[model samples]
Target chain A: MKNIVIGQYIPGKGLFYRMDPRTKIISVITLMIAIFLLGSIPQLLVAFSVCAVMMWVGNIPVKRVIRGMKPLIILLLFTFFFQIFFNKEGKLLLDEVMHVTVVSVLGIVLWTIIWRLLARIGKFKTVLLLAYIMGIFVLFRFLPFGYSFTTFRFAIYEKGIEMSIFVIIRLVIIISLSTVLTLTTKPTDLTQGLESLMRPLKIIGIRSEDFALIISISLRYIPTILDEAFKIMAAQASRGADFAEGKLKDKVKQVISLLVPMFIIAFKRSEDLADAMESRNFVPGKPRTRIHELRFGWTDIGVGVFTLAALALTIVLKVIG
Target chain B: MSYIEVKDLSFSYTGKRMILKDISLSIEKGEWVAILGHNGSGKSTLAKAMVGLLEPNQGTIAYDGVVLTNDTAYDIRKKVGIVFQNPDNQFVGVTVRDDIAFGMENLMVPQKQMLEMIDFYSEKVGMKDFLDKEPSTLSGGQKQRVAIAGILAMQTQVIIFDEATSMLDPYARRDLIEYIQKLNQEGITVIMITHDINEAMYANRLVILKDGTIFSDGDKWSLFKQPEIFENSHLELPFSLKLAAALDDSLPEEKAVKDFLWQSISNT
Candidate 1:
């Protein structure tokens, strides 16, 4: 659970860290829009280079950034497969029909047994697994046995691969840019930036300050709530709840028990928090000053202008192309 | 007028079950008062009422002559602060420095003054080194100390500890009690609500509550003299107090009780 690092701010001293949060946030949005606007591979390479530079200049650890993308691996894979299977443009890479029969079924089963044994034989299991999947695809394309009427055709188009790479790169760039912003900016500054950026919404009757306050408070409590939930889980486990080792029905009952206690604790906590807040003289809707004021210096201006220029250049090039 | 005055205070959560009943208490400026009670004995409820967190169903609570009503609750709160049990729950900020600044921000203290107060009070509570650390990362004792620092930054005349150290270990509890004692000695009124009679011994005055009412309110020495009151209130006598009572001989004092115990153990 501690590995879940969404919205976490890592302290650092770098260009992105020193820049005002509003600048970082606006720049990230602009960069993301620019990435989406890129039409050709060259433009994407440029965008990727810009993100790489930002990551480097921010002193963000490359390994940690990749770890941040761990949760998106499944989504990236899904998009990759969806684009590859459904897309039907550009030159064809493979087109073949293969038949399946009792002999082929038995052969495939035997092959799978061998593949499983091979998978366990070495440290390169991932490589072996990929090779096995490719082998199965190859067998489906070329292997011939059984009735022709039941034959299956498998094809791969060049455009499918290009499209998949494009989409995946776009997603990676967007996610990494946002991660950079969160990594560089503290949660309080982020909230303050959002509040100030959305201050104009006050004319439309939206309380952005209050909204920012709620978001900041919820972000602060996420880890604390998770810690409490784990404690409750442990306590229930000590009482023989058997959350880990149980039938589906019993596991669900155990989960419900945990949730009930969590909800009760949360409600009680919110009540206590209300009392604490009130005792400290916190009045909702009243203007409160902060100790650290957000100031937009020359660096913020430079970064803001640079991002806007990049966004405009992308839009113009995309239009011309 | 006393520093804090609560007269004929009564509170009922559902208008059916009374949590506090006809409670009247007053504390002088710079006095340290400890409220001791068993579980569900309404001591916490009383603390809340004193801090303007809960509205009493009847009676009035005044701080520095300002009545704690709906209209004046905010003003009254500015003069009073509370450190509740469950250190994690009361934390309103993401970091220790932010939590300490929370009250100052609410009071609209200027940025310069807020920073100075945060530095002074955090150092006073011995949490200057932990200003950047998250509240979750701090120990229970450290969190309570941060809470105290936050209250101290508010510069309130009276600070109430609503069993704040109950969740801490013995060492942390003693460390917190020492901080609270230091704060009291600095002319801040301290109201400590706890179930630990040993902890209550640190206070100059002790108030014992039983079943939603004040059972006894007097000096600590007078309260320790009556072991039956301790039993009736479901509060344990400290080791020295219990030994003194069992032996049917008055002990010299709390400090002497330990020396006497050591001598007796050696003699035996």
Candidate 2:
């Protein structure tokens, strides 16, 4: 199955579903900048509220959004504890005798920050668009980057750690944006947008139709593969195959057995695809009419403007704060 | 030139088993030839070899006097296409539209032509509503319909049905046979591999195989006249033909004997 569902996109006339993928993508970039640039409490709160409103407008169930947080619960808790106990720079919300022991404080802060940030990165990719953005704010307190001990510990202060942190944060924002785009737009519609967006690249001798066909096929292949995987699993179960009951070696062997059948099916499909393609007389450099043409209505213009505004605000906040 | 000519063709599979030994056959333009044999009799192997899917160990295969080579095999494929037995294995596209478009793509058909051809062939197969439907959503018969449409859309003069209708239920099989007969009437050379003697009866020509050898090659009447041929090839005669033979003891010179037996059975 594909990393994303293809034509399996939900069909509806909902407002969020009709927006351009490009605009949605740009909006994601705007959110990323805003997340990174916000260093103060007011800015972070504003970012959090914006994500929350978007989630409501998109009609996604809030419970499902929060359910995605299950994978990062530990990281979230760590970050919150780190921020409370170690980040002495922040205001003290609690106090106790011997509570602020230097070793414990440092370890807790380091571990908490690392886990919190890791949670955001993981949730951004795992959660849907609005859910991912909400996750960024909700998971902010669980940074796992800090230490979690009450005693002496070894630590490294290097550029590698710094880069890794930034990389994870960037991945979250990018994933969140793509999540929104995929959830709201149909794959076919997205392909058209991709084609149009790449139209300018024709001057450099790139044909967009070929690219569009590849994308559309890939998207279509995803759901089919997933369905095939489930079928294979069921077939294996019926034959007394077990995935969870095996030891490490047995699991590896079991997975290998599964791959054999899957590979056979995939190769057979590729051959058929080649034959089908040959028979259909599909040639490069041929013009074809799209039955479903994407048009920019006034709503698109409004969305574009809103996206640009969001982007401008994000940049200004980053520079100012 | 004949539609397709294979002179003294011979092939062998693994273990030095001779399959299609010295198999010389020529199919004229617009002639429907039915090849009949039991399983492992090399009938399907011969059919595949003729379509350029399998290479001949000895002997040349030609279409319209053009030799079959790597570069020229494609041209032969354009003039001829094979529909395999399994419908699921025959399809490449997830959707009917894509599958039909697939054939046209290989021939380098322009996008506009591909669309028109896809519509034309899908309609030909009577799958208008299923154009956008996924291949899995179709029934076995419907998938065959799509497969046939894929070949026909390619406009191949010679189409080989390699047990194409074997997987379908009786009703669907009957309909598919009728559809194929219609294509034969419309001047498309059809070659079908089947053990069904009744289905092969519709062909103007028949070749019966036994143990990788042609046991009987002639008109349907001649082939049926030799009961030994059916015994050796593991085939059963159609009921009417068998009844006609049984009545030959009383009416030795009866004309239209099959018709007489049919009338008797229906009246009974």
Q: Residue by residue across B30-141, what tens digits does model 2's lDDT show?
A: 9888999888889888877776666888887888898886667777788887877767666666578877766766666777777888888788778978998776567778
Residue pairs in clash, model 1: none
Candidate 1 ranges with C-alpha deviation above 4 Å: A1-9, A90-94, A98-133, A156-158, A203-205, B223-234, B245-268
Cα lDDT tens digits, model 2, A228-286, are 77789889989999988979999998888888888898788767555444433344576
Tens-place lDDT per residue, model 1, B1-268, is 8878889999999999999999998889899999999999999989988877778999999887888988998887777889999998889887899899998898899998998998899899999999988776789899888888888888788889999988999899889988888888889898899998877878889999998999999998777668899999999988755665566335456447655764653342
Q: Model 2, DockQ value?
A: 0.23
For model 1, the docking class works out as medium
Q: Point to the candidate with the largest TM-score.
A: 1
lDDT score, candidate 1, position B92: 88
- Candidate 1 chain B lDDT trough over 10 residues, lowest sum: B259-268
Q: Local distance difference test, per candidate?
A: 0.84, 0.69
